[model samples]
Target chain A: MTEAVLAADDHALLKTQLSSALRRQKLSAFLLVAPLLIFVTATFIYPIAGMLERSTYSPEFALEMPRTAAALAPWDGTDVPGDEVFEALALDFKDSKTRQATGRLANLVNVELPGARGLIMKIGRGVDRLQPPYREALVALDNDWSKPEIWQALYGLSKAYTSRFYIAALDLKINRQGEITTQPEDKRIFLPLFLRTFWIGALVTLCCLLFGFPVAYWLSVLPMRYANLLMILVLLPFWTSLLVRTTAWIVLLQNQGVINSLLVWTGAISDSNRLSLIFNSVGTIIAMTHILLPFMILPLYSVMKTVPFSYMRAARSLGANQYTAFIRVYLPQTKPGVAAGCLLVFILSLGYYITPALVGGESGTLISNMIAYQVQKSLNWGLAAALSSLLLVGVLLLYWAYNRLAKVDGFKLG
Target chain B: MSLPVYARPWERLWYYSLRAFCIIVLLFLVMPVLVIIPLSFNAEPYFTFTEGMLKLDPAAFSLRWYRDVLENGMVNQDLPVASWAWLSDVWQNSQWVHSAKNSFSIAIGATLLSTLLGTLAALGLSQEAMPARRFIIALLISPIIVPVIVTSASMFFLFAKLGLTNNYLGIVVAHTVFGAPFVVITVTAAMAGFDRSLIRAGQMLGAGPLVIFLKIIMPLILPGVISGALFAFGTSFDEVVAVIFLADYEQRTIPRQMWAGIREQISPAILAVASILVCFSILLLMVMEVLRRRAERIRGVTPA
Candidate 1:
């Protein structure tokens, strides 16, 4: 009985130690992973969150021209209100050179607000500093400072968070009636550019697949010794600058380029170098496909390397023709690689900026180019952020869709 | 098959034709870069037909353009003063050199930091005790999935607000953000086939964690680390969009400088610069391939 009691005591001791050990393991894992986790969160997650925040960022026009914005808030949009709102706005306008500030507010009102340019010009010429004349001029325009439409606009602009940027990006707007409506017919098509961007990306991906697949297959079938040598040929361009490659295409495809000269020399075309290849869709595709071809081939080759030849040979021995044997046996095995290559090419094509910007001229520009112009030229960070967020969301959705499809297809690529 | 004579003359002809077509395609792929290298050395600036297109021209070589580029002083577009006084006074300015330094600094800082972190993460991940390993793996590589442009734009606003956009630390941090994913991939791959007991043996010998890492783990995974560093350097060197938006004049990188040059003008100077950049990247790639082969040898993958 004493020995049994001792054994029970030993079991109790072991249980206590085991539980503590388990807890320590958990703590250790948390410690090990914590630095990386926090780093990612602080550097990546936080920055993206801040970007989303900037999308809704609004300049404090209310603080600067409170009297004007307040006085105008109660006025109706269709008819001019009591003179106080206008007077206050005019006073503020006279008192301040708020082109940068007021232009943002105007964009909130309408991106291309009529007379807003004049407002900027007036402010630029009139307001050297905040003075009595400026205030007096503002007070003389109108008195009612609480017009609903004006307040709505101001309120929309006041918050550091609002859907206005995204709404504007989609070519829709909040009407004076406080309802979202389609933009004017001519202006109702912001989404078309986005659609066009996707269309171009898809077309480029298709082109790469069409061109890349056969070459990749040929490389796969070639002797290993020769294939390795040829693979270097594919990779040689990667050593060159992307700009150099794109510019080389520009040199080759231009109207007075080697292609034109050769075609004319061969009598393939008439004397006139009629083809305007540069600064067109054809140039954009040709350059981008050439640049991205390796991306497709590499993934396909990696997949093909592991596939056994016996599967095809077995199918052939079963009375299938060579084409049928290859298709039935070899092709099924390559689906995963093909999907991976297509996804890589397609997704990469979506973010292309330089090629499209350089080669596409007016019509071939992608969404990224527009975003760049907005940031650098127009100085429209909010709109740029909103558009980028759309793109980010679009890419994320695509990745998610690809993950789902890849799982179903059982294809894998790093 | 030989006894049956299943293949006809036309079939053999078709196969041979296909092979020839493949050869031509291979030649097409190889010719462009080959053409550019020689063109870069041509005495004449234009890319017209060479004197001996099929035959080698020993006398046609000239370093005049390269010398002109190196000897001429670089002047600021905004200000006419010499950028750098040495050689052509252009080299006297710190713009190109400073930017190159920044790129190197950021790339090296990012690569070293990420490689260390990735190695540790890989060790922790390889251990079965780690919870949610698959989820963590996915999250770590999420940057590879997100489009770089969006990342750059998003980071631009974030950094500008934080006053980090134009700073060296900011660029390092941005580079590190992208660089970590590559390290994780390569180092994880290296560790995938690594033996666990070698580390355990070190532990049993009373070696500390740091000691084991240095003495045992690092040697085994050094190739992956090196390759990851090469990739990081190349990425930071070639990266333009982020650097363009984030950097001002003081922080402009080489790629950014080249990009501006390209957009604004076409010059033989750019060709010289391109050739230089190409040489640098190829050197890095060659070093990487050597290290990779060494790593494979360590892992018992026989070299072809």
Candidate 2:
């Protein structure tokens, strides 16, 4: 009985020791990845979160013109707000810090209210000489100040957490009746741009597949010596600078460029009938397909390498014709690679900025180009963020499908 | 592909046509880069080949465009090429030189940062005991998968808030985030080939973790690590969108300058820069090919 108790005690001691060692191993492993994990989170995740936050969060007008926003907040939007709201606006305009600050507030409001910027600025310019009853004076300074749409739009901008940017991104706005309505026809670019972006992405992916399949099959069937050499032809461009490749396309495809010159010289077409190749959706698709063709080929080639040739021989021996052997037998085995490559190229093309922006002229621009314009030119970051979020969601959804359907081990590239 | 004796004439025709189609596709892939090299050397200010160039006249192939690459932004263009003032002016005032410096410095900083952190993370990830490995792997590599515009736009907010935009360190950090994934991929691939028995033997022999890593794991993974670094360097060097969003004029890189040149004016000086960059990439590709072959040959060898 004493010996049995001693054995039990030793067993408990060993169990505790083993558990502690396992814990140490886990801890050390966590410690190893912790630095990079934290770095990615800080620089990558945090910024993306901040971008999402920016789309829904614009407190500039509300915080900058606090009393006016607060006073304008409670109106039911049935009509023009009372004199109290007008007095608050007059005071806020008069007491605002700088001309730029007033302009900034006016700009934000004008995005929703249309004519509010000039009206607000007019009232601000003429406010110093205004009388005690500020409502009459404010409306007199600019007749637009009395409009219910202006007041309603101001109320919408007052909230710290807003849907205005997202609404605008969807090409909708809060009408005077305070219900969401479609943007005026000319302002309806984002939704259409998003659609066009997807269309371009699909078209480019189709092009890549059509071109890539033959090359990948050729590489897979070739001897290792020639395959390796030709693989460099594919990869050198892959490794070349994106700008360099883009420059090459521009040089080759412009109206006065190499391809057109050769065509004109060969009498294939009249000199006046030069093809407009670059700066259009056609160019966007062509350049993008060229840029992304290797992405499709690489995955297809790797997968095809593993597929045995005996399957083809077997199918042929079973009285199938060559085309039937390929279609019935060979193609089925490459579905996973096809899916992976298609999804990859499609996902990549959706977010393309530089290639599309450079080659894509007025009609050929993608949603990403519009987002860039919003950020850099218009300075409408909120709308930019919202549009980006839409694209991001689409990409993430496709990626989720890729994970489920393709069974991707990890994202591998050279 | 060798034909079987049972092949018919139609089958032979189909096979040759397929060969022709692939060769044409191959031309489509390579013709653009090849076409640029000859046009970049044009004596005239035209993008298309001149008649003289076609005729192989020496007058049509002056290195003037290459000279223009050096002298485009020189403050004193009239100074003699052999003079010290001209050389110094080229160094200080040339637009391409400044961009080249910016690209190299940024690429190097990103390479060092990525290679170090990525190698460490890869080591942890290669181990079986790592917690939430799949999720972590997905997160770490998400930068590449995420649209760059979103990433750049996203990072713009952070950098703007932190006052990190308009600085080299910000671009460096941005590139490091991008390049770290390649390091992770390559190093993990190398570790996947490593023999667990060797590491176990080290443990059995009472060698410490650091000692085993230094003596065994390091040697095996060194080629992978170096190639990964090159890939990282190449990535940062070639990247433009981030630089477009994050960098100001003083921090412009070669690709950005090329972008402006292509957009605003079509100059063969830009093409000269392109040729130089092409040579540089060929050098990088050669090195990578050698390293890849070495890694394959070394994959399953047991360390003595």
Docking class of 2: medium
How many backbone clashes does every candidate have? 35, 0
Q: TM-scores for chain B, in order?
A: 0.83, 0.95
Task: Flag regions of model 1 displaced more than 4 Å.
Answer: A1-30, A57-59, A67-78, A81-84, A87-115, A121-160, A174-178, A184-189, A221-224, A404-414, B1-30, B50-61, B72-91, B94-99
DockQ of each: 0.40, 0.59
Q: Give the TM-score of candidate 1.
A: 0.85
Which candidate number would show the highest TM-score if scored against the true structure?
A: 2
Q: Write the per-residue lDDT of candidate 2 for residues A161-257, one digit (tens) a residue.
A: 9888889889997766779999888879889999999999999999899889988998988887788889888888888888888888988999999
How displaced is residue B1 in candidate 1, in Å? 16
Tens-place lDDT per residue, model 1, A195-304, is 87888888878877776777777777767657766776777665556777776776677776567766876799986645888797788877888888777877788778
lDDT of each: 0.69, 0.87
DockQ of 1: 0.40
- In the order shown, the chain A TM-scores of the predictions are 0.80, 0.94
Tens-digit lDDT string for candidate 1 (B37-77):
55566676665335653356766766765655554434543
